[model samples]
Target: MIRAALTSNVQVKVLPGPSAVTTALLLSGLPTDRFCFEGFPPRTKGARSNWFKDLATEERTIIFFEAPHRITESLEDAQTAFGSDRDAAVCREMSKHYEEVVRGSISELIDWAKSKDILGEITVVVEGFNPGTRQFSVEDLVKLVIKQEEAGESRKEAIAQVAKANKVSKRVVFDAMVAHKSGDKI
Candidate 1:
């Protein structure tokens, strides 16, 4: 094999333009201060389903790039994982002449995706997990920790994950863990 080293001293710069990720996030009407960009979901159905499940506890808003053809399937899985009423937005062909945006609950988006033959670049924005929007009891929180632990996470890691996901303090999760283990009221 012949080895050749090539280097170029070139500085190239251009005006930053709007990207599909940020633009869709902004169009979603969700919080932008803390957000995460998930470039694209898994192509296979099983992997994509698991991927969505893993993001169930994410506290930051999520942005996903999706193809128009798979939008309906992805939306279905999203609805199953994030629940029917989770706030989300579907942006199609953003910034183009035929650009369209639909913002609503996951259920509504699912309906929209299934209603017609979608064509164009698609971006999906989902609101972050908000504990306030849904109530969880001590038992529920404890159960979540246990589930996380069962999913190959350490006890401590599971507790922390549960705390963050539920928007509760570590102490709360620890107390719940102790109460649960000792069969005492929390």
Candidate 2:
């Protein structure tokens, strides 16, 4: 929003208005800090599936504006991409008299979406990826590094490869290696 700024075409002024994206986000009862708004999801099923797959690993809470007609489809794709247990909220008719919000796991939302015909503008908020839940033990990391090394990669290269593949830092992998050699717990 430009505040009293002049563009190449015309002058613009800022106006106070409630953001449906943020409004829906707040109503969803998810984390407000570090959220991202992704405008309308892809239309085609294949493309939407691919897009959601890529977004599945995002750490920041995600907000998406969607059409009522596509709500069920989007929820299905989301469940497939983010897994059935991911927390999410579907907000309908945001900032209006008939506003409604359904909060639950992705699978539960899918059931609710298919339960009845949906109406009005839709906003979907999904909790960020929880890395803690998908952690790899240091022993696991060391084994991965060893596997890569057995595949003809040097120790440095194997460490780097294992770190990148596991979405961990090189130092973490190095520590794991050291711990393995020292017979110390990670």
Candidate 3:
């Protein structure tokens, strides 16, 4: 019946699936230079929210695969956890049929999704932290470590936070801090 309608010149469209989503993600200006796709965070309210929270500060761009039925809810959850103003994109039914891409702040997309009953697969592209937005510097790290030492984080614990946040090795952070104090190049 559907094919017969199309044979009579009826218009039809196809939606792209995971493959198109992946390719679009690869091309998205975010930072596929290095990134990861955590397809669909948990569906449960509590677990899903926590997962979003965990990824809130991730410096790398993230691509998510979402079902149409859940897209609005997922976008809302992402806005709440990653900050409403967070940069993001939603591409649905990519290459084949009924393709649509909405790129904007998380809140903007959330509002857009809520206004319509979405259909087809969706891939969300979100911008990562802009370069040089990091609040801490080498000096700041040292100062924080000093404070942590006084409060309770072992030298090791303080160093770990520095490494985790900076995406460097603990030894690198330690050596740099020590060299800075001693007036030597690290």
Q: Point to the candidate with the largest lDDT.
A: 2
Using lDDT as the measure, name the better of candidate 2 and candidate 3.
Answer: 2
Model 1 residue runs over 4 Å out of place are 1-16, 136-186
Q: Compute the lDDT for candidate 1.
A: 0.81
When 1 and 3 are scored with lDDT, the better candidate is 1
- Residue-level lDDT tens digits of model 1 in 54-80: 787687999999998899889898876
- Per-residue lDDT tens digits for candidate 2, residues 1-186, read 221122233432222147877777666667778999989889999889867866877888899988888999999999876778988889887656777778799999999999999999888999998876656677888887887788799999999987775578999999999999999988
Cα lDDT for residue 36, model 3? 69
Question: Candidate 3: global Cα-lDDT?
Answer: 0.70
How do all models score by TM-score? 0.67, 0.66, 0.60
Candidates in order have lDDT scores of 0.81, 0.81, 0.70
Clashes of each: 0, 0, 4
Alpha-carbon RMSD, each predicted model: 12.2, 10.7, 10.2
Residue-wise lDDT of candidate 3 within 1-186, one digit each (tens)?
433544465543433345755565643434566666888878887777767856766878888888888888888888765667777878776774466767678899988998999888778888775535544456656865675577688888978875775556687779767877897764
Identify the superior model by TM-score, candidate 2 or candidate 3: 2
